[model samples]
Target chain A: MERRSKITPILLLAPAILIFVFIFVAPFIYLIFQSFWHYETSYVSKQVFTLENYIKLFSDPYYWRIYWRTFRLSVISTLITMILAYPISRMISRMPPGKKGLVTTLIALPMIGGGMIQAMGWMTMMMPYGAINGILLSLGIIKEKMTFLGTETGILIGLVQSFIPLMSLPLIASLGAIDPTLEDASKSLGASPLRTFFEIILPLSIPGAVSGMVLTFMANLTMYVTPSILGQGKIQVFGSFVYQQAISVGNWPFSSAFSLFFLLIMGVTAFLSSWITKSIQKSIYKGNEA
Target chain B: MKKFSMFLLLFVLLCVASTVIASPAEAADCNWDEATCEILDGADFGGRTMVVGVWGGTIEEIYRKYIIPEIEAHNGKVEMLLGGTSDRVAKVYAERENPTMDIAYTNMFESAKGIKEGVFEVPSADAVPAYADLYDVAKIDAYGMSFAALGIAYKPEAFEGEPDWPDLWKPEYKGKIAMSTFPGSDSEGFLTIAGYLAGGDDTTPDLAFPKLAELKPIPLFFANLDELFMMMDKGDVVAAAVFDSYTRTYIEQGANVKFSYPKTPGAIVTMDTLCIVNNAPNRDMAIAWAQMSLSPIVQEAFAREIYFGPTNSKLVLDEEAASKVIYGEEQANSLIRMSTYMTDHRDEIVERFNREIAED
Candidate 1:
């Protein structure tokens, strides 16, 4: 019976494990192998191993610019998303249980519509003759219509709007997990509301904030649709560059190499951020104990 | 037991005999010698299915509305795999060993590339009868289904006269023109135009890069046709190097856009070609579909409906339709066929474009 219980759990997990191996692990291994292959021409890749693809990528100033731009935009968008999400998450966290459900649903509504739909919505609003410009014109904010469709600012707006929920949901969970009695005790002890928030609530929510930032940052880093649509092919983010190489240029090996490098960079960044956040959380908890 | 076995054998023999007798009756009763007439009369395809890789949006809608039903009437099924030209070509390459799509529609440059890679089967006159009737410019390795003249699309209010290709580089049009990105047909066409202006032909195409860079304050690079037209209509862009067919569509929809073929070298014509994939499952059906696509009736419909210039020399459009397209032998002769050169240097062109033009 004990053996049966153990075997039963394995049997239940078999399908999931099989799926993961086939879908994720297999493709990842193939991608790595492909990155080493030599590119001859469009639709023609040689199996001969070479580091020429990597060499070319590193030597090119254009690729370095794109990588730097991608990281900068991602970091900026994540920061902006966090700033916008904190107050909303806090409000939802403090709401009564029934109302909190409604508020959370409202906050998650944009996600339910999917990224493409939201992007199109933003495109309509951000176009020169679009609603935003119309309002700006009517209100006499500017003498002429502003061009937002092909600018980095437009892309950043799209990134933050699309990823705000990713930042907020985790924050809401972390903030809600905190005991309300702690705030009450701090207030009774003659602490200002702002001081209580900074000293107690903010420190406690670090875990959630870190996770949220990581999620949003990673998403923004790999963003393709929003930048492609809003930036009007003017913006060459890393994801779009990879797509251009693979599809448009038909350099699969080169694209694979580029993707591998992108993965390495993203992996290193994610690791460092997670490590720093964990260290901060540990130190804060240790200090609280003292 | 012996009696039962005899009866079973008799039943099998009877079924085989019936099938043999019925097969010839189901065969199409049309003369194969007269290909155009045969297509008009329709031919039975023995219930085969042809999967076509083509562009989506209105193009797909037009095919579904006018073309697919005709194939269906001939007892054939058509499954469409719709995407951009590059996407369809990529799929063909990925699935080269066992191709999922039987027929792929791509631009002349990509078609030439596919021909070099051996992804596409070399089209034969016997397979596609309409191949003989197409203009010389349309007869690449693959059969050209339609053509679009690449020219300047400008707002009338912004300019007094039609702007030539070089006029876009003028100070007045700086930051006012929209340009299509590289690895696309429009950009390739513009690059050739730029090359011509810089005193270089297909031989010294690299000279175009420096000239393209000179057209400064760097024009907006539009992602798609919709965005280009929308930007033009919004006055964000005053002029763009665009296809005549797209400009016509926008004009018909009241976009206040005017398309002009530059007088200096005429328009740079881009051909959309159709090719049968190598080792295609439905080879005969794919050939038949290609024949139908290049037929006069379908060509006329495409020209009339979508403003796509017909490649079939036999196609005679109405005055209105002809006005919208680059029709007749003169226009066809004037078309600059840059497929060979573009195919050879596509990688360098795209790389340079990204590094120089796109980055700037």
Candidate 2:
């Protein structure tokens, strides 16, 4: 009976494991191997052992700037998404079940409509003569039309809009798990609303907020379409840079090296963030015990 | 005597039968006409699909009308893989060993590089007889499909008249000048012109970078014609370096833009070439497709539709159509092109462009 159960589980898991290894693990291994290969063109690579690709990446200050800028912008976008999602998540958590579901779906509209479609939408409304400027100019908010499409500001707007749902869903889930009476008990104990939020609600919601921020941050980190469309070729994010090298210039080895490097950084960032979040949670737990 | 007569008759009959059977096979691949290129009697493709990689828009439409249907009529199927030149180039190179794309259209520089790398098959007159019908400039180891001159596409309201390349530096149009992305014909042409303006030709092109930097804080680096035209219409972009074909196409669509062939150095010549991938699945079909593509039928179709200058020397357009496109050898010769140094340093130059021009 024990052997049959084990065999059954293995059979059930075999397809998924096989698929994951085939699609994800195999390609990842290939990517690592290719990064070390010599570049002949974008598509053609020689299986020679050389670190020329990494050497170029490390020596070039331009790549360093691009790396730093992508990290910085992703951090900024995550913080902004967290700030915007908290209030919306709290409000949705307090709503009736039917209303909550509808509101959540509405919040997810940007994600559902897809990244490309949303970026394009933002583009039409953010151009110099686009709707945003048209309305602002009509109201005499500014004498001249403001440029948004080609700036970091435009890309930020797009990133925040796209990632807000990612932040909100987790917050809503964690917020809904919080006991409503706990908030009332804190209020009854003569704690103010702000104090209740900081001492009780905020601390309790930290896990959800962290989850949301991590999701949003990762999304922002590897962003391609938003930056490509909004940046108007002025901005070079990691994704766009990889695409430009691999597809546009046909420098695959260098692009693969760049990608592998980004992946390593991403893994480190994920690990560091997880540790930091855990530390924050432990400190909050100690404070509550005291 | 009867036996001798019988043997003689049999010999004559056998000779006549053998001649009939061998004549058709010999005449099948003959490319007879040199004036107007027509599809030659070639092997039936057994209804197999020949994958073609080319640009989508009006270019695809012209191929569908003039080139694709002819292949279909010859028991072949043509599947179009539409995208930018770089995408096609990447695919052709990647799939060089066992290529799915039988034929691909690419820029002259890309085709040249591909030919050098042996990813694309070198064109020979024996393979594509229509090769002989193309102009001298079109025979760049691959079949030249179209010619478009790189020039300024400017809003009429911003300029008093046709603006020269140097005039783009007028302080008033500082942030108003849009540029195309680097590692492309348009950007390279603009860079070459900038180098020329700084008193250095393609051979001595050291001063180009600083000259391009003068137009920094660039408002836009347009990837497509629609985006550029939208900015131009909005008055956000006063002028931009663009291809005459794209500018003319947009202008006909009621866009408020005009193309100018800047003097002192004139317009830069940009040729689009059709390449057959090496070790392609359908070599015969790809060759036939090449014949149809380089023929005057498709050439005239492109000239009529999007004003793409015909590479086929035999193609003769009416006066009205002739005035719009790069018409004769005189006009074709007037357009300037940079040397292979641009292609040689393309990777490094692209990185430089990313750092200096594209990045803020």
Q: Candidate 1, residues B231-310: lDDT per residue as tens digits?
A: 77767688888898878988898877898889766688788999899999988778777877887877887888788989
TM-score of each: 0.90, 0.89
Q: Model 2 over residues B99-170: C-alpha lDDT tens digits?
A: 899998988888888898899999888888889888988997669988999899999999998999889998
Off by over 4 Å in 2: A40-46, A179-181, A184-192, B1-47, B69-76, B203-205
lDDT of 1 at B318: 78
lDDT of 1 at B240: 80
Error of 1 at A110 (Å): 2.1
DockQ for each candidate? 0.57, 0.48
